[model samples]
Target: MTRSLLDPSAVPAELRPYLAELVQRVGILCGPHLLSVFAVGSIALGDYRHGRSDIDVNVVVEPSLPGEVVRELAESLADGALRCPAAGLELVVYDSAFVGRPSDQAGYLLDLNTGPLLPERVSFDPAAAPAFWYVLDRSIAYQSERVLYGRPVRHVLAAPSQRHLLAALMASVREHTTGIGHLPDNQVLNGCRSVAFCRTGRWAAKREAAQIISESEPDFRPLLETAVRSFERPRTAALELPATEVRTFLAWVRERVEEAAESRL
Candidate 1:
């Protein structure tokens, strides 16, 4: 029998039921091969917003688990079937081998996206995913994941090296600068979080990082403030930040990240 490590009380009250169902379904689908299920992102960081945040879950399974089981698991937990109560469910499944020796690049067996705010996606190919995001997310998970079942996070999740993290941060900055139709709030907050991680080598929640940055960089406070406010609003109610200001903020962040990366060499 797998040792259960879930603490229902640690989860937000409203999300508890959904999480319970999710864990139960996943256990049923993956059977004895399921190693662990845990929460990351906003929920793990204590910054979850009932109507605005997605539940980001990471699951680990034995290497021998069949691909068909993985596909069935994804289909069962998809938006229509599981009916995500939050913005959506962003779940990634990894075999124990990958978890034991995680790559700096993408190594997920499945990347499942579901929810009203997110475009539904079920990706099985690592090459199809952006590697930087996975690296950064794993870094964050190492620092603050909440295990819902199976073994402790530290036993299964490796902390990404500062070099890999900085690389990932730089890649994210490049994406923001060149990407089209980006979410303005995400742009600003991501910059704030990246700068925080670069300087402190610690992961802070999006708004927490923004608040810390706002004090030291008063010039960007208004932009950060606007982004935080917009981020807290329901998706339908959020307002867009000015494009020029967002570009400027991102440029500043790019400089900081580049400086941080250079200083280490």
Candidate 2:
């Protein structure tokens, strides 16, 4: 099976060295608690865009870690020494017991959303961590995790059922679409990708997912095209898609996602 760390050759050429540096630094920081580390999200999905993608990693440690140690690890990740390879490094360190089974409380020791110069205050308490959305992260990890150390991903992670995954995606879509005004292009495309996953078992990158949706629903082609281009060239300034159309499309997608989720239920 696919049980090894991601091949550097598979990553963007510029990102290889930095990816290697991450593995080494994480291994050092976690020490005995570190059971395994794996790459997830777009990096593992083979749809990583150089300028836009954040390297998402899951660190599996012992059942529990001392609060102090967790703090240190968080600081290390935010430190300039371990600069992120792309937009930023998005990471979550999960207690092994938490991953082995579900819990009422957060399962992570540390979680952060940080990039080169914009480091958010890292949190050690799982409950306080902003990125503790387990269902979504676990689903993504189950689908595309690549081992950086320890046992293979299949051995470490329990695959989430399609029903569970769809439900989580629908919940996210409902939350994001509920607000008024134009949803960001990334969020818009993410809703499309989640719908795509519900229809097809495969996990598609944002651009690929938008393409599939546009083909399946021609009316949204122009919007999806705009979103895809924005994702590809984050630096380029572009005209925004009309807010009315964006809201309409999101509402339509929200209904379809809810329908799909209900069927599974």
Candidate 3:
């Protein structure tokens, strides 16, 4: 099997030590069963904010990895244990077999969340996780091609299909519009990113996507700018945007995604 490790020189200096320790701990825990370790989200997208972003990671392991090892790995790297330097560490462990397969549903061996912005959760069941978010995340990770360790990302992870991505984008829009979860800044930026992804079959950072929209649709520039500013600043408390306007923006995103999907047909 192909193997590679991230070049510390390639990442921000502040993250160097944390990532080094993470690789070391994971290597010790998973041993030969470890297939790969990669970063996704803001880190991969080159928009990592020192205090705002989560250190999103995807760890792939051989199908034979022991359940005990999985639990131990989670417990070891959890925020307090590994000492997450960012807002948190959102890590998902995927069986190598699952990475090789294509499916509409999301599946993972472990979903560990640790950070100050959110509560801690160490989840093992896919049924308990948000499948749409996983679908979108997998698509983004595959596209980002940021591999911190092991074989190349393309060699290990199959890209989620456009249909699945669009479906996930639609679901995300619906979820945000309902205002059941997610912060206002997240809701706004996510909507902008979804719209941009639908228009161009490429993933862009949240801030980048907002810029794309502002240039193309000047009418929404003010709102998009506000969201981008909010995203850059450190969070102190829950923030809110105009609900009606946020919903309206998401509706436009849903419409655009539908249009893009239809064009492919």
Candidate 4:
């Protein structure tokens, strides 16, 4: 078991204290059963915006916990859900069995945002969901730059293979863009980042990917710039992009991802 806490200064100004207290409370709640806890997504990436982005966290715990205990924990977590300064919070609890064993399927005990105990429950299939997505997250954890608590990320997560990383990228893009016509800034930026990862094995934030696309694929600069702007400054007023253009761009990104997958094979 490993435990190294991060300085509160790493998180956004408005969210640091809240996250610190939340992590502390959760740690205390789990106590002896707690294995590790850390963050991911925009917040971990340091690009999270107050009103636009979400805080993503993963808590690993002892596998012996009863389902009822998990439910109780979920309910407790909900009491502070709205306290998140970002758009919302997304937190999942996984068993400690995955510490070193890497697999394409990860079994999670609970997802706070879409669990049975939450009011905003959504459909989720843990079995069919590809675990390859954890590859990027594992990579982030190994870096130790974003870990919030528990064992050092490298000790807790297995290093993901290139094939797994690319597979996860494709899967995420398909899930987010399929049948979706209008693209938001995050979607657009994520699509570009997927393309960048597929071409070069290097993973990057959306902003970095936008810069890469601007330098390499100048034709897409206008769209990428617009996406960056939208992501940086989210408007409270209902804002929608041209559906036709979004659809076309999404199709192009999908095609690129497919081509990248094929090239790998």
| Alpha-carbon TM-score of each model against the true structure | 0.95, 0.87, 0.94, 0.84
- What is residue 220's positional error in candidate 3, in angstroms? 0.7
Q: Rate residue 196 of model 2 by lDDT.
A: 91
Best by lDDT: 1
lDDT of 3 by residue, 1-265 (tens): 2333477765567887888888888888889999788889987888888777888889999999999999999889988887887888889999989988666676999999997775899998988976897888788889988888887888889988777777787788888877675778888898888888877788899999999999998878888888888888876643557777777787887788778778764
lDDT computed for candidate 3:
0.83
Candidate 2 lDDT, tens digit per residue, 1-265?
2233456675677777776766666667666667777777887777788767777888888875666777777777774657776777878888777777643344576787687634565766766732325667776677776676676766666766666667667767866675542336766788788779878977787888898899999998888888777777643343466677778888988888888877877
Scored by lDDT, model 2 comes in at 0.71
lDDT of each: 0.87, 0.71, 0.83, 0.67
**Model 4: per-residue lDDT, tens digit, 30-56?**
777876778777767666776666667
Could you tell me the lDDT of residue 261 within candidate 1? 95
Model 4, runs deviating above 4 Å: 1-5, 79-82, 114-119, 122-125, 128-136, 143-145, 179-183, 235-239
lDDT of 1 by residue, 1-265 (tens): 3343389987898889889888988888888898888888888888898888889999989999999998998899998898999988999998888877656778999999999888999999989977997888787778886889887878888877777778888999998876464578878888999899887888899999999899999999999999999999977677789889998999999999999999985
Off by over 4 Å in 2: 1-6, 102-106, 117-119, 129-132, 178-183, 235-239
What is the lDDT for 250 in model 3? 79
TM-score pick, better of 1 and 2:
1
True-vs-predicted CA distance for residue 194, candidate 4, Å = 0.5
